[model samples]
Target chain A: MTLRAASTAAADRARIRAGEHTGPTSGLAPGLAQANLVILPADESLDFPRFCVRNPKPCPLLEVTDTGSAHPDCVAADADLRTDLPRYRVFRDGRLVDEPTDIAQFWRSDLVAFLLGCSFTFEWALAAAGLPIAHQAQGVNVPMYVTNRRCISAGRFDGPLVVSMRPFAPDVISHVVDISARFPAMHGAPVHIGDPEEIGIDDLAAPDFGDAVVVGADEVPVFWACGVTPQAVAIQARPSLAIFHAPGHMFITDRHHDDFDTGESHDHP
Target chain B: MTLRAASTAAADRARIRAGEHTGPTSGLAPGLAQANLVILPADESLDFPRFCVRNPKPCPLLEVTDTGSAHPDCVAADADLRTDLPRYRVFRDGRLVDEPTDIAQFWRSDLVAFLLGCSFTFEWALAAAGLPIAHQAQGVNVPMYVTNRRCISAGRFDGPLVVSMRPFAPDVISHVVDISARFPAMHGAPVHIGDPEEIGIDDLAAPDFGDAVVVGADEVPVFWACGVTPQAVAIQARPSLAIFHAPGHMFITDRHHDDFDTGESHDHP
Candidate 1:
C-alpha cells in the first residue's frame, strides 16, 4: 500500500488510541506534522511555558492546550491528548515510572499539555530538497548531545541545551540551511555548524542520546536544537509529575507540512 | 546635531526617566528599537503571555519581566520600567485614570511588565529603503482601525484585532514586504493589502485611533497588525488595574535595529 493508504496521521492516531500501534511514529505520517508532547500539572505549568518562550529553538511551541484541557485546538482538531500519541513516558518526581500506550488512568483536570514543534517537519523538508538525513537513511535515531551552553533559566527549569546532529556536504550547507529556515515553527536553522568542540561536544562517536552515525570526511556536522531538551529539562526539574512522548514516538497532528511555510504572512495577532 | 547624537535610545530613556521629556518618542532614537509596554497585576499575568504567543503578529513579545521586577533583562540593562518610558497611561477597572511620566506611586509588588515589539522598527526599514511612510512624511500618527478578525483568546484577554495602515505603490509592495519580513519580532509584513473594507474598516479616512494620512491614487493601502491590539484588549478585559505606554510615547531600549534580524539561529531552549 502507498504511504497515504497505509497510514494517514488520523488513522495512525486512531490505531494508537486503540492500542494497536505502540511503536515509534516516525515514517508513519510522512508529510504531516508530528509534535513533541509535554504534560504538566497546573501548579508547575507557569514556569514551563516561560521555559519554552525563553528557549524557542529547542521548544518551538505549536499549541499550548488550555489549563486542564487535552484538546489542542491550534494544531489538531477533535483530538484527545490523553490517548492519541503512540507511547508516553511518565515521570514522577523526575523518575521514570511508566511507559504506556495510553495515559487515560493518569489524566487529571489540572494537567496542561504543551505541543511543541518537532524536527520531523523539517526532516521532510530536507528530504524533499534532496538532502540526506543520516539517521533516517541508516534507520537509527539522530545523534543527540548535551552542550555546555546553558539554557536561559525559567523558574525551576534550568539545564544545558541538547542538540541533534546531522552531517551534510560543505557545498549543500546553504541549501540545507535555506530549506530548514522556512519552518521556524520546527527548530528553524542550525545552532552550531562544523565545530562540535565549540558547543562542548567532547566526542561525536559517543553521544548522550540516540545512535551516532558516520561523519563523511568532506561533510560538516550541523546541529539543531533538539525537542528533547525540554523533556530532559522537565525531567531534571523533578516536578511532582511530568509526562512526554517517548523519543521518536511523536503525537501526529492534522496539519500538513505545507501549513508551516515561513513565507506565508502571519498577519493576525 | 546628527540624529544619533541628538537622541540615542539610552539617552532618550534617561531623559524620559528624569521627566525631562514627555512627548512622543517618534523621530528620536532613529536607528534603535522602541517597544510598547504593558503592565498587569500578577493575578492576570499568566493569560496575557499566552495571549501574546497565540497572537504573535500583533503582539510580538520582546521581553517579559520577572514578577514584581521593574527590569526587562532580555532587552535592556539598567532600565527602570516605572520611570523609563516617555509617558504611561494608567487604567483602573478598565477606565483611564492617569497619564504620567513616572508610575512609581502606582507600582505594586505583584505587577508584571511586558515589552512588546512595535511596528516602528519595520517603518524605519521602509524609510531606509526609500519607501514613503505617508504619516511620517506628513508628521502625524499612522491611522489605526479595528478589524473583523478576532484574536485568539487567552484567559480573559480577547478582542478584535487592531491594524495600522500605510499606503505603498503596487510595484514596490513586494519590495516593502521583503524588507519588513526580515524582522518578525517587529510587526512583520502586511496582514491585508489593497482592501480596507474587507477587514471591516468602514472608511480609510476615519480611523479608530491616530491621524489618518492621504492614500495616493497609485498607492495600495497595506494594513499591518498593530501593537495597540494587546493594550486595547487588556483594557477591555477590565482587570483591577492595567498600565501601558501612551500611544506614540514608547519605551526605548538598548537594542539596535540590527539585533532583531530574523535570520539568526534562535536555538536557546
Candidate 2:
C-alpha cells in the first residue's frame, strides 16, 4: 500500500504499525482524523454497519475496509489495519482476552474493519472555533454515561446509547450547538441538553466511564453521542471474535478533519 | 406502525396506497421530502446498502427497512412500501419486466427495502430559498447523463456514476452551491460544475435519461449526482429480483426538506 497524501497521520500510523509506538494516539497527527476501530468477521458483521447507519449520532461511520482487506483505501491510502493502531483489544465471545501492540497474527481473511467518526474531530473543531471544553480544561477524561435511549437495533448489535459530557457556560451553549452541528459525522450536536434525568442519567459527579468534572456556576451540561458505542454493543452481542482499539488509542488516517463535513464530496465512507 | 407526525405528505401517501393515484409524485407533497425506493431480498442484497454508504453522493440513504418488513417506520411510519409508491418497476435478471402500480404481488417474505434521499429535497430547498430552477421553469425533466466516474463497488452492485444537470447564471452559482450543500442527503452539491465533457458528458441537449431544457446565455451548467444510480447498477449487476420506483414516481415521506440538513436530530433514519 502507498500513501497518496502526506501528513503527520501517515507518520503516526507507520510508527504504530512498526510496534515502535504503543501508547494513546491522542496527541499525534494534530489536524488529521483518528478513527474508532472495530474489526469483525465478514460472515457475522452485516448488521453492525447497518446499526451505524441507523444510529449515526453515536456511531458515525468514517470508512469500512473491504472484506478481508486490511487497507481502507478511501480514508488512508497506505494504512494497514492489522497493525496500524497503537494498541489493540481482542474480544472473544464478548470477553476481553488480550491487549496487543499489533494484530498481524490475529488477522484473518474473513475480517472486515469498520472505522467510526471519533469526538476528537468535533473537539478539534470546537477548539478551533474558540470553544472551551470542560474536561480538557479540568485535565480529566470526558465523563460518559449510558442513557435510557436504546438504539434502534439491527440484528444482535443493540444497547443503551452512551454519551460524553462537556459543560459550557449558558452564554456559549448556542455557539457550541451551531459549531458541533457543522460536523454530523463527528457525533454532530448534543443529543440531550439541560436535565440529565430526561435521558435517564442520575448523577453528574458519578459517570459510567471516564472521569468526572466540575460544573461551574450557571453552566449547562451538554452530552454528545460517544464513540464507545460499538465496544459497548460488542460486549452485549458477544461476537465470536472482535478487534478494537484500546481506549484513547485510535487509527490515525491521512484524512483531515474538514473531510467529514457531511458535504457529499468529502465524507466518502 | 403509526405515524407520529402528520402532514400533506401523509395524505399523499394515503392516496397512492389506495391505487387511486398512478402518476408521478413530484408535485404531490410540495414541502415534504420524496425518496427514491429500491427493494431487494434480504439474503442477496447485503452489499447494496454498503454500496450506498460508499457512494453516498448519488445514494444518500434515508431509511433502510428491517428485514422482510415493508413498513419504513422511520420515514413513513404507517406507509407500506409494497403499495405506497405511485408506480413500481420490477426488474428480473437485469431487464425491465413489469411496471406495476403496486408490488404486493411481488413482495416476498425476505424482502428488504431501501429509501434514498432524492433531489426533490434540494429542489424544495432551492424553491423555498427563492432560487429559480432551469428545468422547472422550462417545464421539463431535469437532464441526466452517465458520467465517467465509477462508484466504489460492493458485492454485486457496481456501475458508472449518473448526474443530473441544472444550469444557473454565473452570479447565482455560488448561492446555488451553498444552498444544495446544506442537504447532503439530497445528492448534495454539484459533482461537476463547469464542463460537461470534463466529467464525460458530450452534448448538453442530449441526455441519457430525462428531458433536457434550454440553457440560457451566460448560464453555466451544474450537475449533481442523480438518484437513478442504484437503478442503473441493479440493471448491470442483474440481481434475480429488484424493484424500484418508476422514474418521477417517488415515495413521499413525512420527512420535511429541512429535516435532511446534516443536523443530527432532523435526519434520523
lDDT to native, each model: 0.85, 0.84
Best by TM-score: 2
DockQ of each: 0.26, 0.36
Report the first chain's TM-score for all candidates. Answer: 0.94, 0.93
Q: Write the per-residue lDDT of candidate 1 for residues A90-170, one digit (tens) a residue.
A: 999999999988898889998989888999988998998788999888888999999999998888899999999999998
How does model 2 fare in lDDT?
A: 0.84
Worst 10 contiguous positions by lDDT, candidate 1 chain A: A260-269
Candidate 2 docking quality: incorrect, acceptable, medium or high: acceptable
All candidates' TM-scores? 0.92, 0.94
Candidate 2 lDDT for residue B112: 87
Model 2 stretches with alpha carbons more than 4 Å out = A1-5, A262-269, B1-7, B263-269
